[model samples]
Target: MRKNTIRPTDIKLHQKSRVLEVAFEDGSRFSLPCEYLRVYSPSAEVRGHGPGQEVLQVGKENVNITNIEPVGTYAVCLHFDDGHSTGIYSWDWLYHLGTDFDELWAQYLERLEKAGHKRKPAPAAG
Candidate 1:
């Protein structure tokens, strides 16, 4: 089965808001939070050596993307302010993440809760 590879038509990083806006060739657009990308990084450090070895990333609520560099023609290397830059995000992976945002995010929160890890608390309202 030969699957068609769809590439992003545009990628915009909102540094202040810490969101990465990606639009694909199929006209699908997604605004993914930097925290989501950092925590779900495909790097070995985050993904671990194999199945069931995944490390739960905590305290990434305030993580910022310092850079986004194209990795050949198939992926992009995201450099996070937290010093994680090994993840090579493939087009297909990114697309799947975007489309599966809600489900994945809920799973992440559940994992964090089970591990007794908490993200940084939001600032109190003035």
Candidate 2:
């Protein structure tokens, strides 16, 4: 028998705060901002088909998740208020995003700065 991988035990969307809280079986929990998820979407529309083809997402500071649809037992499709719903976030990918949030977020900010895009401040949590 193979050892099982860490899987999300709970996922909650706080529309008011614009955050997705995910708790994994490994006792790790992440409160991921909607803006972060939108910019870091794994969809081909955002990630592109190959390396060095990533599209920089801007003006998404206030983007919020509109819906969460489960896909099979391993993934979910997040529908965003900005009409972006193509990204199918797998359990493994979501776990990776949670674990690597800090570095990935910094990289995204750096990319935005390099592109001369000034990101708006996130809305205050209510």
Candidate 3:
């Protein structure tokens, strides 16, 4: 697959909405939910050391990003509220996640279902 030379022009964290809105240099923008980002983190703990050793993340429906630190000029280290901060989200990877949000989220849900795991309940409506 060919990676586009696109780069992020801006990133905004909406704490209230629980989403990260990213705008790319190529004019493409995406709103990625915090839950999605948490579950798909590329950290060693979640990805494990090799194929087939992937760990499934559960009970992260309300997880939030506590911080976003730049990793040099190529990536950003996300500090999730759940105390997860090992994943270095590169620009390319972020773009990929944004663009492929739908399919990837569907796959995640399927995996959760197959494993007999369900997301935690959302907070009650007022």
- Write one digit per residue (lDDT tens) for candidate 3, span 54-116: 899999998999999999988899999999999998888898899999999999999999999
For model 3, name the residue pairs that clash. none
The lDDT values for all models are 0.91, 0.92, 0.90
lDDT tens digits, residues 1-126, model 1?
118878999999998888999999999999999999998999999999999989999889888899999999999999999999999999998998899999999999999999998878644434
Model 1, which residues run further than 4 Å from truth? 122-126
Residues 1-126, candidate 2: write the lDDT tens digits.
Answer: 114667899999999999999999989999999999999898999999999999999999999999999999988999999999999998888888899999999999999999999998875665
Which portions of model 2 show Cα errors greater than 4 Å?
1-4, 124-126
Measured against the true structure, the TM-scores of the candidates, in listed sequence, are: 0.93, 0.94, 0.93
RMSD of each candidate relative to the true structure: 2.3, 2.5, 1.5
Candidate 3 runs further than 4 Å off: 1-4, 124-126
- Candidate with best lDDT: 2
Report the Cα lDDT for residue 112, model 1.
96
Evaluate residue 28 in candidate 1 and report its C-alpha lDDT on the 0 to 100 scale: 95
